[model samples]
Target: MDEANRSDPPKWIQQHAVYQDLMHLDVGDSAQVYAFFLVYMDLTEGEEIAAVVGVSCPELQAVLLEGREKEGEPVQMIYPLPSHRSIKHRELRSILDRGAPMLLCAVASDSSLVYQTV
Candidate 1:
């Protein structure tokens, strides 16, 4: 098969696959996400923010981010989710709004065409 058309491994089987597999893996647009916040986010320790947060996408998407963190929003470290964000969806965003933090593994908020494609 052509490189882009090659079948990918099952998502569950590769959850903890090494980085090498990740490099070779090609997830489709559905698996792409706009951005990732962070992996181990824990906001229960006080009015504190994290040091790292990340945003990522598949090969393509039209997702956009809005609004600056409200006054004094804590900064956090961010890194790509290392996996195709096939699991995240509109529901995840709702969860975030409800103050439930998540380790969003996959999302495609950027692609305006995402709803149609799905």
Candidate 2:
């Protein structure tokens, strides 16, 4: 399998309680979880975002429901981005500013797509 597509959470995330609970969740795949954050944060619409992530809208919706049921209000803690432009940088800044765990997925310079918790 491609390294970028690997499903395992990073070492630090596995050691962190909040991220551990999230990683253990049977919420589709890691990409779906990232899609959930994108949708939940209102960064993008669910259908389009789901398509971009290669997950069906229903599947993404189910993941959202599962996260809500399992993580409760904490699942809704994503910081909203002010704009889609420079979204990744904005998201990283928001995550750092809040000092909270966040799901992030992106295409690297070498064209590898990666998804992980930060």
Candidate 3:
């Protein structure tokens, strides 16, 4: 991985096999889209990777919130994603077209692509 393209996730996250695999994982472009969204997110809470209120897709909202409506959005705080199974953070960021907020497209364990929103 190039220095400019890779990011160091938290040590705890690095311990996870899923995270390790995703760091170098590759998936086909024709992946099935499970859900999509157009969310506004922030990394305020310590390790929680959450989107702001007004998430456009209710289905994606439900997945991220996971029935914790009042607790607030903290999807998961695995920082500096470096890259996802098929796309890199830089590429996603460019797609997002914003500097801070990111476009999150999580690959679920079932091999489905989730939370792909712009």
Clashes of 3: 1
- The runs of at least 3 residues in candidate 3 whose Cα sits more than 4 Å from the true structure, single-residue gaps closed, are 1-32, 35-84, 103-105, 111-118
Q: How well does candidate 2 match the true structure in TM-score terms?
A: 0.28
lDDT of 1 at 32: 27
**Candidate lDDT (C-alpha), each:** 0.30, 0.38, 0.31
Candidate 1 lDDT over residue span 18-37, tens digit each:
32233343333323221212
Model 1: residues with Cα > 4 Å off, grouped in runs? 1-71, 74-80, 99-118
lDDT of 3 by residue, 29-103 (tens): 112111211111222242233333322222222222111213654333111221234544555444344223333
TM-score of 1: 0.19
The true-versus-predicted C-alpha distance at residue 28 of model 2, in Å, is 2.3
RMSD per candidate (Å) reads 12.5, 13.8, 12.6
lDDT of 2: 0.38
* TM-score for each candidate, following the candidate numbering: 0.19, 0.28, 0.23
